[model samples]
Target: MNYWLIKSEPSTYSWDDLVKLGSDHWDGVRNFKARNNIKAMKVGDLCLFYHSVNEKSIVGIAKVVKEYYKDPTTDDHRWYVMDVEPVRKLKRPITLAEVKAEPRLNDMQLVKYSRLSVQSVKEDEFGIILEMSEQ
Candidate 1:
């Protein structure tokens, strides 16, 4: 299965907010690249739940429950969303600093495209992040 990273501002929608709802459609993606990433998602794909802005850390793991569909919150047909549910909160959040320090993650999109809200993660990068979280 493909691995991904989805970011949200805690003030807007925190990891706790998703956990409380059980599952929710990830919406409000305005960028074309981010939108495509959402569209590419499939049911069962895993995502890293990241707290962007101030936190700048991956706080939990999530799984895609449903594939892309018309965004209900918008009338624009170009926009889409996918349903995701919290898999589990990480024992420790992996901070941006930690990821930057790791040479293995140097080529990760999260490092190169820091502003991208939705990103594709290589399997090795995904595994490394999980390992860092375990520490």
Candidate 2:
């Protein structure tokens, strides 16, 4: 399965919010690239739930429950969304500082395209981040 990282402002939609809701549509992505990334997601793909802005950390894991479909939040046909459910909270959040410092994660899209809300993650990078969170 393909791995991904999806960012949200904790104040707007925290990890706790997702856990409480059970499963919800991941929408409101306006960026073309990010929207494409969302479209690329398939059911059962794993995603890292990241708190962007102030927190700037990956706080939990989520799994795609449904593939892309027309975004109910908007009338624009170009927009799309998917369903995701919280898998589990990490043992500890892996901060941006920690991610940037790790040489192995140097090539990550999280480092390369810091502003991208939805980004692809290499399998090895996904494994490394999970390892870091445990430590």
Candidate 3:
């Protein structure tokens, strides 16, 4: 079970939007690296839902419900998307400031590739973030 972090701007699509919809296709990823990350996802993989830009925090958990498929929003075949469902809202959001200050999360892709919309997370990093969110 690979762990991942996916970002969305709060104004465009927030964690609450996902929870209300129940589940939805994760689309609009234009970066080659991010698209590849989406393609790499498998059903049942867990993902952290992050609100980028202003909020800059991980607000909830989600699970992949479907594997990669053609991105319906785009005409290009190179892009792809996957379906994800909200697992639960975190007891407390893990902010970027908090993440940056934590030595355990120093090596996280979320910190290394700040602009990446979809990024992989190490198991230990995922565990640490989960533990932090509960506090």
lDDT on C-alpha atoms for all candidate structures: 0.96, 0.96, 0.96
The collision pairs in model 1 are: none
> Residues 1-135, candidate 1, lDDT per residue (tens digit)?
999999999999999999999999999988899999999999999999999999999999999999999989999999999999999999999999999999999999999999999999999999999998888
lDDT of 2 by residue, 27-79 (tens): 88999999999999999999999999999999999999999999999999999
**Candidate 3, residues 4-47: lDDT per residue as tens digits?**
99999999999999999999999999999999999999999999
The TM-score values for the models, in the order shown, are: 0.98, 0.98, 0.99
Candidate 1 deviant stretches above 4 angstroms: none
Badly placed stretches (over 4 Å) of model 2 are none
> Candidate 2, after superposition: displacement of residue 6 in Å?
0.4
lDDT, candidate 1, at 9: 99
Q: Could you tally the backbone clashes for each prediction?
A: 0, 0, 0
